[model samples]
Target: MSGLKLEQVVKRYGATQVIHGVDLTIEDGEFCVFVGPSGCGKSTLLRMVAGLEDTSDGKISIGGRDVTRLDPAERGVAMVFQTYALYPHMTVAENMGFGLKMTGHPKAEVKAKVDEAARVLKLGDYLDRKPKALSGGQRQRVAIGRAIVRGPEVFLFDEPLSNLDAELRVEMRVEIARLHQEIGATMIYVTHDQVEAMTLADKIVVLRAGRVEQVGAPLDLYNDPDNRFVAGFIGSPAMNFFDGTLHKGGLRVPGLGDVTMAAPRNAAGAVTVGLRPNHLFLAEGDSHVVELSEQLGGVSYHYLKASDGTKLIVEAHDQSAPKPGSRTGLRIDPAKAFFFNAENGLRLR
Candidate 1:
């Protein structure tokens, strides 16, 4: 269990810069997840930490040692990739012990380490089997077990669950979480899936276009995003954003309706109003849900369109859902509304 730190990290290919200057720190035994869209340079950042990709400029330190120019093996980190890179012909035990064997570890020591990892990963029953004989999840576990046998100071996962089916992904996610708790190893996981980031991370680092957007607890990012982008990216259905103008003591969603809030201390001009679908409630007196839908379940979503076609997604977990053309009332607690500058997308207090 070691801490990792990046200081003004940058990566460039030729003259094209991919990773902007980034600074972050992961505490010892922390599970930090890196999340962003494709081409966002998340994998590039992870690779740099692994010593697989050189940093264009800046410093990387692991366990208080500067490893900026060290080789991957010298960095004391083990990586698990999306593809299970187990040797096809080797048996599970052989594959798990291969690294130690190559490193000149004694035969007995290698066997003991491999056996311990197998037991920890529940692969003891499949030690003699080859990768071909194991399920997708089991193969991934073997890949992880191989890392564990090496006894690394930190674990780096690059979308390790991306290749699995949805159900298996969930199962493996729990497995990884348990591994972290049991082993207490510092881990840095990269993924584009927000759900994965939210579910698995002790802290999440949200990136955009190679720059750090926000780094915080999952619920912190969901409930108090620093900008409109962060707010929309961290949630399930995503927070609803609409063009609106700041008024005397509130904001107005043109065509749909207006919500008056406690006067913003220092607010003005045009702004974007945000509503999380889970927060939008169907009420009779003040709330107006313009459109509704029932997805053949107890929890149905309502898609309300303003006269100007501005859309809002509302969740009606119970009660009857309205038809597409039918109208329903909606209530938005002004305090629950998020306001961002329309032009800059920055939050307004």
Candidate 2:
């Protein structure tokens, strides 16, 4: 059982506390990701798990073995950092085998491990080349290969694709996913980009303000968010929120007029209505004006604003669409709508 477990983990830097009472579990061979905004302590938590940072409190166990006080070398974990801190002067083969060589492995043994890692990473052709000769994606693969050669029980990646170009990042995402399927090693990855979190993780831990907010599969988090923050942060272009006053017959929105809605149990007064951009559609009537249109080949996103200045994004699939600045009516499927409490941002349903 090479799984990871954390119990009431906390990290404090002098008088300020950064990570607070975090408890989590990463199952063996699971690809888990820690995602959040800057200064949210996602990286700090990952570093603590790596044994790079000391645990101020609480227990950490890997494979059911207590490793809270263990040094990084003794923890059976390998980390791939964001920066490709390769030795420019060393060939790919040498770079991959350097750690094993230093640890006094026989030359033949080191060579075998390096060779296998190279083959796994598709870096066999580049083994003789220096780091300077490789492209961004290749260098990253070399970094991963370096970690693989260590034969660690778990792999930790700290935003390893942040430095790559957009196209290369996508390419490397596929490479990493394939590597995980082939090796089936327990993995922990940290990143602020939700898109990366969505695409790469088998499980995602969403953190905010040094505390974990939610945990689930990617689509689970998207389709069934616990609160407004999780809903807004997990989706691209974000979920649109409109404030309104609830009445017996309908909800009164400031800019868009009253919308008839079935009231929830004990629901009344101030409230917030949540609508995903994809759920909104064009209708006949002139209640809203188009602000802009973003056409991305096959699909388009129309930005609209009501007379009272409430903004919305409506995703339109057809090429023939309303022109910018045109007035139109909008309709939402009530079944697709999400309701949230205006006071605390918690999902009402």
Candidate 3:
């Protein structure tokens, strides 16, 4: 229900700094996700926002109140961790109301809040059941319900669906999305899964080595990345990168049968060319060898190795798949290609 802000937030351990000076703003009711690879400090940043970790130097504010020095209990934020830390001895209803009960809320008020949370999480039927008696998804929902009863200003999720099976993960993702829609509360989620960020977030913050890589909508980052890391990290299967030489008239790529294509404006010397799997297709002559083909019902992924030993992946929607070791050619869509400076990996406009 309240917006959150961080100004020059920083975290350090002795001589090593894990979180660099970061500035961010989350509008009220916006669902923001932090995504990156392991050891990128995404979880650490989230924990700092929750007041579970101390900030080495910086300022954090929630709903116009500075909470950088406050304890976790006073931050007006509820965190749902990766593990469902439910009490086995207590029933679903009791667990959901325990916080309020311990805080001196009356029995009738606690009961009403617990009931409302159960109804919102669709756990009304399992109120009397213990954590051991419920399924994994049910237990997770109970944990979420516990948070819901507190009525926090912001919700923090730290890979809450990591323990569930694939099917259950998908199911819980839909459930969480619906929960956000109904409650309309500001949420900050941390995960290493870009797919989750793509599906769940209104805005995504991509991190690398404790530095902010990019911050934008999921598709915005995917479609137009500022650097090579963001471009490579945002898409599934990753984008194929090739070494190219920019000449007077065009760019020459040795991996693509030494093909020459139109170069971008102001680009010169050595450059990197990037192409997505869906933008490259199997063509007529043999310039590459098929390594493997993965058929996934609706689409197939063809893994190929060019004569220069460069690897590439092509996504094909048709049912036919070429056999391994078969020689083939590739056709890349010029309009969809991306050019980057080879030395620094910055996009060339």
Candidate 4:
């Protein structure tokens, strides 16, 4: 029952308010991720839950116990930060057991806990190595092992993989995912990397300007977004958009031409058409011209612009991807099209 709940959470610094009233519930053993662009208050909200930042107004409960006013150590939560934060001179085992030692745990008990964590994190072979002797991923693992030795009810990670190289980031992502699956603990991870959010989270909390935009499972948010922001932010290449206005049965995009949308006619004023890059395909009509092609081995992405100059991206795996400045027709299944209100950037559904 180590779930977490936040009710009407708010944070303010003098007259400037951040982290608006946000209500969320993360069930026990759920891997929840907080993701958004920089300065979007994702980290701030996570810090608040960790008792590192004060909540201006709200109630925070972990395992049903109110912890908004409790000190960090008293809240029974362990946090792993972006920085490794390990003791430079101490061995891995010593670093992992330091907290328990400081709290006066018996040496044997500390060693036992440290040994268990090392086993879990696959750090048994490097237990005697100092922080300086480990690779970036290994150091981060040691940091995670340090947290595991504490046996906290919940684990908080703040951009734990931001420092790693691309390949290492992917490696560590899998490692963390496996760790969560093996331990089945309640975990909250924060990152600006959408790939990390998509792959690691059982659920995602997308924030903006200190307010929550959407919260749902990764693919749920990807396939069904609440707004333009959520649709655009959750994917890798991102969802493509074009400014349009309601016409007879669809919206008329100046550059993309007329597109039949599923939005209610009564809800229309100025509208936007959202087409995922993966959904667009090459057709035979002269609708667009290829602007650029990004080829990455087996897959390629063709950046195109309509005759009217509305830009779009099409995901193509064909080796003979369209060349730059080549004319081509693009089409999408009518059922897959997404519409948003141009004024508020909200989904038209």
Best by TM-score: 3
Candidate 1 vs 4: which has more TM-score:
4
**Candidate number with the higher lDDT (3 or 4):** 3
- Deviation from truth (RMSD, Å), model 4: 1.4
lDDT of 4 by residue, 239-290 (tens): 8888877767666666564554555555668878888888888888777888
Off by over 4 Å in 3: none
TM-score of 3: 0.98
- lDDT of each residue in 258-310, candidate 2, tens digit only: 56677556555677888889898888989899888888978889899987788
TM-score of each: 0.94, 0.97, 0.98, 0.97
What's the true lDDT of residue 245 in model 2? 79
- Output candidate 1 Cα RMSD: 2.1
C-alpha positional error of residue 6 in candidate 2 after TM-score superposition, expressed in Å: 0.8
- The C-alpha lDDT values of all candidates are 0.88, 0.90, 0.93, 0.91
**What TM-score does prediction 4 earn?**
0.97
Which ten residues in a row are the worst by lDDT in model 3? 248-257
TM-score of 2: 0.97
Give per-residue lDDT, candidate 1, residue 175: 94
> What C-alpha RMSD separates each model from the true structure?
2.1, 1.4, 1.0, 1.4
- Count clashes in each candidate, considering only residues at least 3 apart in sequence or on different chains: 8, 0, 0, 0
Query: Which of candidates 3 and 4 reaches a greater TM-score?
Result: 3
Q: Which stretches of candidate 4 lie over 4 Å from their true place?
A: 257-263
